[model samples]
Target: MSGASVLYDAPGPKTKARNRLYSIVGAVAVVALIAFVIERLGAKGQFKPEMWNIFNYADVRNNLRDGVLTTLEVFAVAAVLSLALGVLLAVARLSDHKPVRWLATGFVELFRAIPLLITIYVLWVILLANRDALGLSGNGPQFWALVVGLTAYNGSVQAEVLRAGIVAVPRGQAEAAYALGMRKTQVMTTVLIPQAVRAMLPTIISQLVVTLKDTSLGYIITFEELLYTARQMSTNIIVNGSDTYVPVIIVTGVIYVAMCLALSGLATWIERRGRRTKTGVAPATAAPAGDPATAADTGKDPAATP
Candidate 1:
């Protein structure tokens, strides 16, 4: 075939140069867009010191702290419960029993299908409906409503993450575990989960970030989270020369971004540490079997069954 017409030919130098030009143009466009946004917000007084100075007020400070605490409270509770529920749901989905699998499948699909805000609002209304009979008084109903809604929504998401993680683990691992006389449960808990968790740690953490953000939905029910406090402060404060609402909203968003970034960094650290371990265990493992060279360099024979 002629060089110009050959299907197997790599891109010509001219084509490669053109592609590079396109990439450069795209990058510049993105950078310009970001710069323009920053400039616009600055022009609107969002970045002004006077606007943020409201946060220095004692009332503002206390309200923000309380909001942060309330946010953390719901996040911690929902995270633990969601993780537990997710594990159970994941295991059930993988169960040999058809009924258990179907039930888990339905539960995961049902909650995940609904909007998170709707779920929280529905639970809040339900609690309000039977407050006396359920003995849920005062903030009890609201707190639990938020907690359960977050759990149901986030738990479904976590279940899908875990299921995908489990599937990503080499099938050979589960088979090997079975060959070693491990029951399904033992293989799953002891073998699959540890490794799958490491493999899917990022996704799990991402779902947790979603859960953290979803806590803002609690504001609709008057649960008083960080966003709620920000909105309240924005409404109550009238800075002499600034857009208080825009500034406060930006600050609140930045706080959420910072927290999520920290969590993501933690996940990245854990993942790297997991990679350095021997048996996919903790960082302090005595060996490094995962590294083929670690054994060879140390003059250890892996074939020796000691």
Candidate 2:
């Protein structure tokens, strides 16, 4: 029987047949649903070669290339800043001093509680209003606003992830470090943080994916990111007597999926590497290979008996 059947009584032949029938029905339903969607899209000319031909235009290609570059730029900056801020916040929240802990907790709670869209919009407006004073120009307000908003929200979340990883460390490890006369800072920086990073690397990379997607929010502030470029192409570039909205959306979405999958693949590779490194060889046995009774009777170290 399958392991799932262990939770309850194994299905009898009749029940197994019924389950197979249900599975077949479900599969047919899914196939029919997909067929219907494809039929509708085909009728709407979404599958027409002309709709996809806009991608062949030089201007469209340039715009998309620039959009992808800008999106990656924002993601790179936000990712680095968020990670740094997260580390600082996590350390502060874990501080022994009550004031520092409370301050860090409040900051994380505040940012994490607010809607990310609202935060980005507010920052955009505020920065735009003071653009001249801040020496801001051409996309500066939009760029900084999006970057800072993402940093605040994601940093707060990353702080919690890191803190959880740190807390999950074996208590004995911390005690052992303390016994070695390491100060709290030394213990955390040298011991807890490194192990926590290894344990939490996957979660960290997942959050970075979230950060990448959230860069789309920059569209609202006119940041000229990927989605914004897609919108422009769909609206302005007419082909085959119709706007290329569907094709543009499909292409941009595939790009986003490709980037996210790349990140996930990197995370998986790193996790495997970490596991291999952590798997140490078994210690060489000092005990001799002999009958335990004989070794004990002769008062010889069982490990040393040949």
**Which sections of candidate 1 miss by over 4 Å?**
1-50, 241-243, 278-306
TM-score of each: 0.75, 0.85
lDDT for model 2: 0.89
* Steric clash pairs (candidate 1): none
Point out where model 2 deviates above 4 Å. 1-20, 281-306
TM-score of 2: 0.85
- Identify the candidate with maximal lDDT: 2
Instruction: For residues 58-122, write the lDDT of model 2, one tens digit per residue.
Output: 99889989999999999999999999999999999999999999999999999999999999999
Per-residue lDDT for 1-306 in model 1, tens only? 566667545769998898799899999999999999989988877777787777778988788788888899999999999999999999899999999999999999999999888988889999999999999887888799999999998999899999999989877788878987999889999989997888888789878888888888888998778988888878878876443898778778888888888887887887777655534332223265664334443445343332
Candidate 1 has an lDDT of 0.84
